[model samples]
Target: MVLPISRFWYKFSLFLACLLVFWAGFYPEWVEKYYAQAFYPHWSRTLRFLLGNIPFSLGDLVYGLALLLLFWAIGRMGRDWGRMGFRSASWLWLGKILHALLWVYLLFSLCWGLLYVRPSLGTRWQLKPVAYQKEDIRRLTLSLLDSTRKYRQRLGTEAVWRPCRDSLVPWTLSAYAPLALAQRTPALDQASLKPSLFGAVGDWVGYTGYFNPFTGEGQYRADLPFVLQPFVALHETAHQLGYAPEDEASWVAYTAALNHPSDRVRYSAHLELLGYALAEEFLLYGQEGSFAAFDSIAKENKARMDPGVRADRKRIRDFFLSRQNQVSPAMNALYDQYLKLNRQEKGLRSYHAVLSWALAHQN
Candidate 1:
């Protein structure tokens, strides 16, 4: 009687696992926000950091060993089950199905959390700027950099990146940082900056710094111009840090790169933001004057964009838009749902909305 009860429970577990796998694939947003914040956020930052990050790094080694044992067990089980006729074969089949369902659940959970929950939580706690002004931008940028410098003094030079990365979250808290500190802050208008041309046709650059959502590990094109690389790197790093919303990631990346001590890094942040401002102006205003301003900035950028950089951008563009790219409309829709679930009113399109906030506060 006890053995029969145990078998029933095992079968029920497998059934529930299959249901969750199906739900996760079809309606990931349903689980993204509430689950992460409710379960994962209560832990101390140190504990969360250890469990989410450190364990994964170590888990890779164990995973290798586990795979070896898994293969051995499967081989042995296949031979043994083959001789047991239908009764044992059915149990083995059930076990295999249960294992597949569990794998799917884990994959869906990670993707949903990374693309939805991380951004929502980070944005919810993001520091909002109290004021906006050119001088304020300059002051805040400098102040943030000073704070990072102090952090480095305590942690040593090797720990410099931590301060730099941490500074990004607070840098875009207000309009002041964008207006005062950025070296070439451009005026925003539809004519000067427009929505990405690719976006007009439902195509997107999708060049985020994070790994592929499904596989959770894959290299992306890294051929952007040096002037743009640092900011892009920081933006992608923001995604890796679990800030999935595009606007938040952009702002965070801008702040990180700007606060970095390296001149090149600062320049990269400024240039990337300037490009967005110009793009926004072209799309929204389309005024001749705004276009003129954009042309001037573009010429300046062109002079700076060396032959190698141009070639690299082209290569990267090709790679991002190629058939091998893994993005899909369903994925975009999933992102949209998650955005709404996280309280972003505009959904996935909110990425472009950051320009409004940037422009309204521009010095």
Candidate 2:
């Protein structure tokens, strides 16, 4: 009787949560003013305070335990089906599953997901949007290429790269100082970026970094190319700061990385942004139906880059190519759908929107 009463309340809670989620979609300003600005920072800071200093990921451990519990529950359900029969047991298990899902959604929303509905970082920053021509893209690409060349020249040899990787979290934390919105400082005591427990498997899944919303921890694959690590750390940290969209997070990371004290960090930003600018430039040519011109210009751009920068680019390309797997495409497609469901209209292609943001900020 007590168990049944408890289940009834859980179901009621789930219904209320569903209504709240729907309501949140329609009232982003209320969500932003109340949840993002007022509620999120406090609880997020508390979660980080409790879990951030731990050397290993408490969040990952919890996830592993949850997976095991799910398997055990599935086996239990199979046995219950055979013994008690479907009519007797199925609804009970269904209620249990729904109860679990309700909690997951509530936890996700409370921790970080509600930020998805907030005004975009561009709007928050009040960056004026401008109509950019192909010439603007070409010029931006060349300028980024120049910066990358200069920064790569500043960063010599693999030895310098190692210390830069080691210092990424601190450098990124300092970089966020100027970018903070009101009451939204990302630099927290003990809230250090961590290496992902999944490690090399992340290469197969095609993610360099992710934020554990449950723990308020930013995590990166430890085995990523040294040149790319700083930007990944910064990107994941942006998520920790409640910039939920990939493009917004990428843009935040780009801005922070460029302002980072170390040239290596700035080089990583310029290198990645250069890739985006080049992609935009290529798209512009394709829109004009001049694939031939794009090809010639791309070759020229590569040839003009510093030799060390070109080698680093090759290293990054070779790293991903070598790790390419069948699972990555399926995982990417699923993530694309997830992004679309969360209001990113372009899905995986939204990451490229950073170039447009950059262009707007430049103007």
The candidate maximizing lDDT is: 2
Output candidate 2 Cα RMSD.
Answer: 2.5
Q: How many pairs collide in each candidate, listed in order?
A: 24, 0
User: What lDDT does candidate 1 reach at residue 111?
Assistant: 47
List ranges where model 1 is wrong by over 4 Å: 1-107, 110-208, 212-224, 286-350, 356-363
lDDT values of the candidates?
0.45, 0.80
List the candidate 2 regions with Cα displacement exceeding 4 Å: 1-6, 84-92, 129-133, 163-165, 181-190
Q: In candidate 2, which residue pairs get closer than 3 Å at backbone N, Cα or C atoms, i.e. clash?
A: none
Model 1: lDDT of residue 73 = 74
TM-score of every candidate: 0.43, 0.91
Error of 1 at 89 (Å): 16
